[model samples]
Target: MTTLSLHWPAYRLFPYERLLAIAEAIALLSSRQIAEDPESVTVTADRPAAAPRLTYFSAYQTPRTPPAPTVQHLIESETSGGSRRQSTRYSVHGLHEYKGKFNPQTARALLNAAGLPKHALVLDPFCGSGTTLIECAHSGFRAVGTDINPLAITIANAKAQALRCDPELLVAEAEAAFRAAGRSRRGRLLADVRGAYLHRWFDAPMLARLETLRAHIVERDPSVSEILLVIVSNLLREFSLQEPDDLRIRRRKSPPSERDPYQAFLEDTRALAANVRVVQRHTGVCNATSVRAHQGDMRTFATAAAARGMISNFDAAITSPPYAMALPYIDTQRLSLVWLGLVDPGTLPSLQAELIGSREFNGSPRSIWERKLVDNSERLPAAHAALCQRLLEMLGEQDGFRRQAVPSLLYRYLAGMRDSFLSVRSLLRPGAPFFLIVGHNHTVLGGHRIDMDTPALLSTLGETAGFVTERREPLQTYQRYGLHQKNAICREELLTLRAV
Candidate 1:
């Protein structure tokens, strides 16, 4: 039998922090070759030579079943760097650009290490951009994901549905839809348009084209229309009058020169269609795994699931919750949300307030420091407790919005996290594994350095919710250089916990 093994640089192995995928890849490659008893592959994470080795050591009888055409194609696709690029095929995943989305490779690697049986149910409560769910589906595991944001759910559903679509049909329909949109001159400003925001980010002619595209998309079948909307949404930020800066929504100083919207849509659709076709060919064996996505708050998902008899049966779960105030997800995709009419401009404040790690707070002033906040603070780990204390102390040192918001935001964020963890715990079967890929943030409060040790804090909190911390693997290390450099070296960590 052919053996496949390699060593990788430490830097490239960050985030997922596991060598299990190497063995999984080998099993996939050698699936049809083994006879009688199916031997397992040994994945070692040791620096045996110059670099860390992802050794897939296995001994097995060969030539049981011939390699299928799809298997041959997939095996041929594996190159020296195939391990890194295999999970993220740049197909349906390229449909939208989401800030703080975890790598699909990480999800796949986690699944490989999870040791769950095929067609097992996996849960991702905070399934931003649906990376974990999509990976689980591709790996032949049924997956269910939930998100509070409707737009995110829409994007995830469209991506999952791409697996069932005919690539040639996708290309043809996308082309016809855009062409028909371009030919229509009845592009008037819709009533739901956030006029000020749209005017600021897009020129009139470009906006007209998008409006026309939206009009045409809505008239099609719901599934087709949803996919087209995702494609259209992806184009907004690409051609927006905004700098290709960081994830946070920011505008450019001047308007950009206009490009043909139809051409851009046509090009993006064709490329995505081709990628989907390739992905379909490679993932034929995983078509049995069911994928379900829901648009709702994760904090209350457990209750909803239990009510609907969808609880406690999940074998595994994986997710990366939003970093503490590091990314404003809703605001980041404001352009798409506004254009798609998914979120109204006036209701943004309420929606933002509902999100965990949100800086916005609309609660009563007295309620901010109530008994509930104190109880939430009590559940925090020691490090988190210190952070909370320091943040609370900062309130006395400052005046105005910063003073009013910081303490409330910190308490609310912690409370929300506690609720989410408890909810997730309820949904997992006893001894089931839950993988969390998360990063921490640093803040200055009361002239003290407060580090939000996310993974460490989460470990402590998981214990309170009947979960035992199994492993804590550090992934990438980031050194801080600016003002808060003293207490600012944060490493993204993969935390594995088991439900009790």
Candidate 2:
């Protein structure tokens, strides 16, 4: 018999997290009789095995003092007590702040619960900022991530590369790049259209400094340059005229106070490098080459990956998919996208519209989607189709265009998700688990609030797309702290499905 105790943080976790922590322990330990106490879980088995690597539990049987705190733990502890779920400050996950990224601890726990073998290939089709991929690498699994957003791809790849590269080499190169950027003289601004567009957001001095930093970054060793670029990109919003707190693009009422780009870059780079060192100490040097991030639509990524000779049969998949009428992802990152030369400014609208669950449709595209919904062309599930129809029926003539577009937008979101499910299922081996952490949302139509059960809807879509719905466990969502609190999701669910 073996009794494995959970870490202190596990006892304080939300209800769903506690459930997942126990499931992960049971799977990893292969226990016969599981007993849960206030502080620990005891499992009886024929014989005890070596201490299991766990996400939410200490591997030792007896309570022992926690290991000495590392730089990452110290930094994270200052903000959120370094709890497992709140410990994003560790590793390259803190390289940049990405909106809507899932908790890395949850990803690690899910991976543990899946009980995948070492070196098993995992897939995250909607890999925003590579949370799952980072956890996969930490767990010694090879990972492939695909996202339609180019900026996401860049950040995700940068994070994975940080885990693989020599920590000292990265720090040295970053310091050299910062020095070069600081030394370069500010030159005359370009007279091109791109320059004119950028001028709207950034004053001349900051823009020139950013451009210099970018140039020096490109000049550095290609292997580590991406990490440096991400550092600069994370600073863009703070320096720009855009309101840093708002999710959408809105100019500040008054220009931001003068800020030091050099100081900010130095601080961010040093902190990121320190966290990278801490990650290396724990996970050793992961093979960055084994972690790949592809920029493409999730609905079509499987086909593209297969054509490129990438592995198609993954052991498992996990993702936190965007909500219906999701946040304006591209709009929020437009400045970074243009400054990084990832996409042309004019194409932002089209790219935004391309994202699944995007609320950016207009003109012909909007009309086409509406027509399809009217005709039921996508063969949506009965409940999903009925819900959309009900929402449409509730809309009155007094409703705004955004309200009028609700039903069609919901239709498009579900259809896209259905396609995404098909695509993801095509890449998984038969019977592989696919987990989605999705939030429930609500919308107002004709002054009536209509709740959208997104997790249940997606489960139905998954069933139609060659998956068997396994479980849908309710998860308690964390509270939002700032301007976005009013728009927070009150409830989320973990939907588990098995590819058939």
Candidate 3:
């Protein structure tokens, strides 16, 4: 057996004050308003849930599995040719509304082919929307990956610059679909009466626009499908008359002037092109071939990656798995999935992380918080009075919402974390290190405080899966200088573990 460990003790908590100050500075430089209200921010003076500043550790107790499990051979391999060259930071700034969260310029993602040891051909099975793959392609690694959500695969593929995609072609087809639909008629010819959920989520004109978008996607170049889909995915939420970003289909009034799918497509094309320009300027290189994003489930990734000609071996892997029961992404994303043809109802559920957010979310509503109340009541024992805290407190300062939705939301989040990480270990190379970015959240469960130290939990979980505890590096997300640390973004522990 081989074991190796390294620690970066210099990593420290962001001085909350400095972090906010820097955030303000960034905002100022970008000509945006910086809010001073703590409630408006994700950060706070509150101390994190009680835990050792990381005092305990777990070691792998299981005998190492054979260097390569026969089960690992299930993944099939295919070969493709594409070279990578890392470029400097790419940026065409001040282009979008959400870019405020972080400096979208620097590239922090790393892959096995770039500079790691044994692990090559990296897989971010949990490639939450594909931030990692985009980096790998530019860094010039032969990267392979998968996602259950088709739209995710499309975005990652587009961002990764998969040579297969051709956006201009897709935009061309979308225009034709709109013309064929006679979108200009604007009379009783449009009927938006089926699918209660769809009716509830989108108004008549909005649905018409979406259908136009869908038809174009169907007839357009499959290669740049992601480019068009990215626009569609964003439009599903964007064109909504709701908060322009709200998801509670039940609330929020419709928009005054609903989008025209043809129009939206044009807008998305511009956004994508500009987004790429920004990416190119900031990162300095454009390597789309290094990214191979497919729409599939994480549990089945070993086979999926293999089909792409990737061996079960990958170098270093970095990702953030959905915490348990946090976001029933499959369910939450159902509207977009169905509209975009990412999944059908029958098989869609399987794409979610199995352990977390499964239909088997078997816990009392307040079990997690009840536990926290018991543990933290001593700290602000008064909070134990069955008080209803804002969801933002639980989700990050920015996403806070009303009281009623907290329980189900928290339950789902935890499940996401558990099942998501378990899936990650299967694709990683033996003795290879995997790093994750995770944060602590507020809530009570089963009369137990539910805060999980990802590195600590993974150390325990990895050993069972035949890995050794390597190192855990924690950083305050609210740090002003590097990374997106907004809305009480809290801290993300960089967990490094080696497959044994």
List model 2 lDDT by residue over 1-500, tens digit each.
Answer: 54444443422456677788777766766765356666666665332352345666543353334433322233344444345445655677888778899888799889988978778999999998999998888778899999999999999999998888777777788788778777777644646666767889988887887887787878888888988888889989899898987998998776685768877887787777777776676657777688888898988888887899978989999999988999888898988888888988888898988899899884447788878887788999878888888887899878998889899999999999999999999999998999999998899999988888899899999999999999998886555223333343447899999999
Q: What is the C-alpha lDDT of each candidate?
A: 0.66, 0.80, 0.45
Better of 1 and 2 by TM-score: 2
Per-residue lDDT tens digits for candidate 1, residues 1-500, read: 33323323222222233244443443344322122122232223222221111112212212343322222124224321354333344546777877777777677657765757767899998887888877776667889999888778878888888766776777777777877887886775745447666878777777877888777777765646677788888878767877645466677654564667778777877777776766666666345228868988888889988898875688998999866665566776788888887888777767776788876665545355434445554456655556565566565454565544565566667667778888998888898998898787776655555677778877887887789999987764333123433443336888889999
In model 1, the clashing pairs are none
Measured with C-alpha atoms, the lDDT of residue 355 in candidate 2 is 90
lDDT of 3 by residue, 110-159 (tens): 23112353224666666655666655554445666665556566556655
From the highest TM-score down, the ranking of the candidates is 2, 1, 3
The candidate maximizing TM-score is 2
Cα displacement (angstroms), candidate 3, residue 295, comes to 3.9
Poorest 10 consecutive residues by lDDT, candidate 3 = 71-80
How many clashes does each candidate structure show, in the order listed?
A: 0, 0, 60
lDDT of 2 at 498: 99
lDDT of 2 at 133: 94
Candidate 2 lDDT score relative to the true structure: 0.80
Candidate 1, backbone clash total: 0
Off by over 4 Å in 2: 32-34, 45-52, 62-85, 254-258, 362-364, 478-490
lDDT of 3 at 139: 43
